[model samples]
Target: MSERTHDGGVAVTAAPSPDESLPAADLAAKYGLAVSGARPSLVEYVRQLWGRRHFILAFSQAKLTAQYSQAKLGQLWQVATPLLNAAVYYAIFGLILDASRGMSHDTYVPFLVTGVFVFTFTQSSLMSGVRAISGNLGLVRALHFPRAALPISFSLQQLQQLLFSMIVVFLVVIGFGNYPRLSWLLILPALVLQFLFNTGLALIVARMGAKTPDLAQLMPFILRTWMYASGVMFSINHMLEGRPEWIVRVLQANPAAVYMDLMRYALIDGYGAVNLPPHVWALALGWAVVVFCGGFVYFWKAEERYGRG
Candidate 1:
């Protein structure tokens, strides 16, 4: 380019560019630029999620608070909803079907309530997880935090609701002549393991739901079937009395059944260790660790695909 000098003579000059000889990739590297929504490494993703812990917690609390705000009973429905479910199950399974044949009324009532409350924890988690990503598309697209937070937050919200509902569980158990004891303390560990398991399951479903929004419509039937197979209203041992040994073992080993069995044994006086399959605690831990880790990795795998076309 030519420029006029003060002396009126034409001057030819050129400016040098540092990036003139570099390719696009090299230029991006030189400027420390990264793709806007590229997936991070697994370790980095974990770190990112950890850094956003406050957001996860706050979001969960906010969701939980707003969950029934518009209802007449508000949060009372959290406890009442499951209790009502227990009543219906008790009527059909306990009275009409004689599912509670072995257990007395005192034992059966608390048993059914505990099972309903505990299983609802997982059921709600999975249901919310299916909508976590798809339901919050606006937030996912508008924010840059780890997508896992959405599902994790929803799981946390369910856990919070379960904790609130447990007060009734305690009263029902006490009302049934099962007083507070050391074993009741076992609920803490059981709840923790269940939370881990639920969170993991939520992560898995969140990813699936994001890819196929129609999955939300189908989850209710799947969950209802799971509830029946989980022995929510009846004992697997009692109901499957004549079934094959392998079938009983498989049903007892199911994570949902395992968790419910643990809680029932811990809370109900009639549900002794004999009611639980061999190594029930070990099964609970295994399910929690396996599902939580697997779900985290599975959800993280599709991190970049969330909120995309």
Candidate 2:
């Protein structure tokens, strides 16, 4: 209540009574408090994540370091692992299946190595993403940040590893007598699109595996099937030649095959327009857009549900 004083027309205000109930808003404002455990809007979440960019990079590098910490050769194993796989594939697909008979022995090794390294990038990114959130529950519980960072950092860790392995890849290309060309500029665009595509897959699977942890186990078999379909070891065009047009289109349009074809066209003399699918760039750009946006939205929709369970 406010009262006027007799002296000099002064006004005085009375304090609230002890028995009067304080308004919730007034109490909160007085205490400078906020809602606990409230989820932010998607925009706010993204902003929060952006604010933590350094943390993401550091987390990714740390994981990359820890990946080989137990191994004797350390980072060399990253390059050696895929190269060894190439050797085995070269044996089976190169020897038993006679897939290498058509291409020059000179470029075929480079072609196979490129496919192994490129595909392994996506494979490793997604595999780590499948476990990103579920595997880091301790950190998740101990911290409060956007869970999306986990998958994104995992994808980045793989990309960093891929770049490291690319040092060996370029050497292998040179060892086989291929030199860098104007066409090699295409590797940037190819890796960019593929990285975006892998990030999308990572987010999609991270959310999925968060709910169904078994996805981690099942992904390898699914990826193995994908590798066969992607034509990592052999030219699928020959096998798909006699098939119906739709099947041929499907095989050619597979993202993994499109990327490998792009790299071969960029890096190898024998693998270009004659074997390339029509509109390869269009197919690649479409896959990147569709998967990345769709997966980001799908993942963001579950922002509040991530660590509660």
Candidate 3:
């Protein structure tokens, strides 16, 4: 038997005697207390995140500002760093290493610049994802919001940075005699798919980094190797000419290389569908969907465990 208290009819019950036992489920239902750190269902989790859209956008912008606040170059570094790297590659590949592989000077420069800028978006997203949870442990522990926010906001920050750099990319393209075309419209969908892909990658890496923390140390080398293999400074097709057909197809189909090829076909004159592997857009969309759906579920599964350790 129980007596009601004045505080919203909360029950006051006598303590159980040694002979009595209370069912945990019944007690929980009566008291309405959920298990601490319980994960939400996917639909509910997404609803909660949607309720916090302002916070995510604001946080992303704040992080972007803070990243360049101390540097004398400020936001200029975002554009300059990639341009400088492109210049160095121009000298090395175009001149010394012969990575240009007989492509016209105009064509190779634009190709390299667009590839560097586009690829860096994904590279930066993964790098920042590694730190998203680990770097914000204090906030994660103190706040009741979704942990996915951190990784997603980090991805947005990178996206904003890349958008800023795209202006320079267009200028570089114009300088090399590649003007706008109907194909350039494809960049819109291409970038949208890539953003999804990057977000998925960010979520996956954020979970991994939150646990291991050592993954961050190895990412740089991994990205560097990927850069070389992605045909950023040179054409993988030209490099692998006369090689087995399957081998050439495999490299072209890689997500990174596929994205670079799409952008090249869109922005650089004469780099069209024929130069690309079959089903380029289809492969890009497939990778984006698979990675995003898989990554979101993967990260959501670990929601409750993110900040505890």
Candidate 4:
């Protein structure tokens, strides 16, 4: 309303806004506004992740390709790296230290190589996952996609690298007299289970890394300790013989050892069915399902905080 003033000036009064009756929260709610970067429901988050599956796959492939881009041998290093590590282990453990006291040369060679390759899958996944968020902060901060994708894609990248190395694994096994047979088909399920387990582990570490960037520096020593305990270079059964049945069982049941045992059992003829932990398949399946689901939820619980400083 406008009114004439005593001299020549006019005064105007503003009308009330229609929205004055609504609180800010109610106004936002009524307009379908939400807090940016807020976490979705678990099921909805899973759907969002699934919606970005193609991005996940392409990102993994790109990372795998670039991993060896600067090396002279390029992708050959994927296989050669593990093979060389196997050779070094063979010289030290199989030759000098006599770690293969029970198994013959053929059995020991294939066993060592298989352990190196399988363990590398888990090792690389962990190393990559530990940096998945911290190493790619730009992407994490600029993008709005699921934060889990980075770690999951890194795990997938390691899985792809392992698949490439499997060619050499097959040659090593066949050269050692483990010809392909009906049981060889078990590699599929074993790899699937291992991939799930690796992905779960990756997700767990990614969340940790995002918060504690210093963790990236600490992971190597931790993984090295895990590798040694996992029997990557020798038979746990042989090394721990007489260490008490329960202790041996506990080490054998560790997820890393379990996956390596499954691969060795599937790929090598002389891996000895007798050495396998009881109910090995059940253990593998249980580890895969439990870790993957638990890690997914654990990571999702902190979704909104991932890219924050």
Candidate 5:
């Protein structure tokens, strides 16, 4: 028998018998309940992810390199694909449809590229996260890496693509005499916030997708609708003129709209016009924290069952 402290009073407690199991901590490093005192908060969970940064970097590099392993184009496809996307959209929106008629931005191409590139990262992260666990059944069963690493790796891979797209956009901006401004520097922090948002979203979707494989199929459609709603192809402000002020306010409530607005403000408007107000940034950061904390706890609760199916 073992004696243990109790809140009400000292009580005698029986220890596990020889045939019974040891505490969870001794079974597996990954299986123990997070002690109340030592358990990680959402920020700490993200820091643990940061501590395993090498794994995320290695996995992202592997995925990117493997894309061209057998192909002649190799990694060139990364640049080629986004270049093609920009060209197609420029042709359709800038030339054929003349969609930028009354937009505040000077040129349409750079605007379109910035919107599409930034939005693509969100789309890819969510879509890939939905299948992260189920797609890695073999590794999930055989390895003990942090499950969050999977989605983080996927987000990093997409970030690589986003970086390439940014380079291309920069060159285009230079050619078009749209010199980058001091505000462009904000891109880095905006990207960090965007990454946090994606990571949190991936965690939530990954758990849901694992339980219901059908989520994988529906993600693309949801993303498509989300993109349209996000104002990626057009300016939201242009459509809000006749609508109720509350409707426009509600649209602004969408986090993606805030993100893209920040991008446009930084990349095209040169920062002064697009600088996020303190209130807006506070709101965005609040949303990110809520999503990340909510998703982290929700997903952590099911860590043990992720590998079962």
Candidate 6:
């Protein structure tokens, strides 16, 4: 069999003449599966990711800093915006509606803060993903980096905001005398899961939005509707009142809602003593895997296309 070096590692063998059957090694080598150095498998994919973890971190940090660099407030906007939103909502819901009839006024602030904080990350991910390619057309055409990095960077920027918002939420919770409990430790893993979810979503939308700019305009309405449907202002349990079990199930199926509930339970309810249902967590995980794998495949398919202006 005729062999050629592929990527300076594997020997890729060409198909044999019509009369001769290619050996397995030759066939495998043809597909870049030679024993010497095979193409990456899923495990290798993760290892490759691990090796480049620094790049991701650095890129994300740079993006975060660059976004705020031009602003007078700089990174303080990350803390300020969420706090402002919480205050507005608190005024309307707490003062006008007196909505905290059952819940304490102070407790309601953190609850709303947590919901808005989490929802803002999702909004930023989806909205930025929608504009990712269009907004970075110059970078896309001029540079060669992972296309996923654009949306990933945007999501990470929002994640930085989320982290800052969480600090504010923690302070608000403390001031309210709601000291964190051991159960609050779950926030670490929950935040990780939330990040995975956001990255996956950004990947999906960035690719789709690259092809259709209309999504950029359409995303905000969708996000607003999602904010309402997600029970950001009121509790999901309250919204689902008198609705059928299946309807509640359908609403709960929203992975964002599940995460919101988890965040509320951990940070607000104190380690989910009320306990977010297992199915909710399972659904969140399932969506994360599906979105990540599917979006990665879809985005990678257009990797070469991203270079086109």
TM-scores for candidates 1 onward, in order:
0.94, 0.88, 0.93, 0.96, 0.80, 0.79
By lDDT, is 4 or 5 better?
Answer: 4
Q: How do the residues 26-139 of candidate 4 rate in per-residue lDDT, one tens digit apiece?
A: 999989999999999999999999999999999999999999899999999999999999999999999999999778998999999999999999999999998998899899
lDDT of 4: 0.93
Give me the runs in candidate 4 sitting further than 4 Å from their true place. 1-10
Better of 1 and 3 by lDDT: 1
**Best by lDDT, which number?**
1
Residue pairs of candidate 2 with colliding backbone atoms:
none
Local accuracy of candidate 1 as per-residue lDDT tens digits, 13-118: 8876878989999999999999898999999999999999999999999999999999999999999999999999999999999999778999999999999999
- Number of the top candidate by TM-score? 4
Measure candidate 2: CA RMSD. 6.4
- Per-residue accuracy of model 3 over 17-111 as CA lDDT, tens digit each: 74346688767876797987789999999998899889999999999999989999998999988899899988988799989884788899899
- How many collisions between residues are there in candidate 4? 0
Worst 10 residues of 2 by lDDT: 1-10
Q: How many pairs of residues collide in model 1?
A: 0
lDDT of 5 by residue, 95-208 (tens): 787666655445566677777878888988898888889888898888765678887788788888778768877877666557877878978877878878887899899999
Q: Return whichever of 2 and 3 wins on lDDT.
A: 3
- Residue 155 lDDT in model 3? 93
Clashing pairs in 6: 272-275
> Candidate 4 — worst ten consecutive residues by lDDT sum?
266-275
Q: Evaluate all candidate structures by whole-model CA lDDT and list the values in order.
A: 0.94, 0.88, 0.90, 0.93, 0.74, 0.75
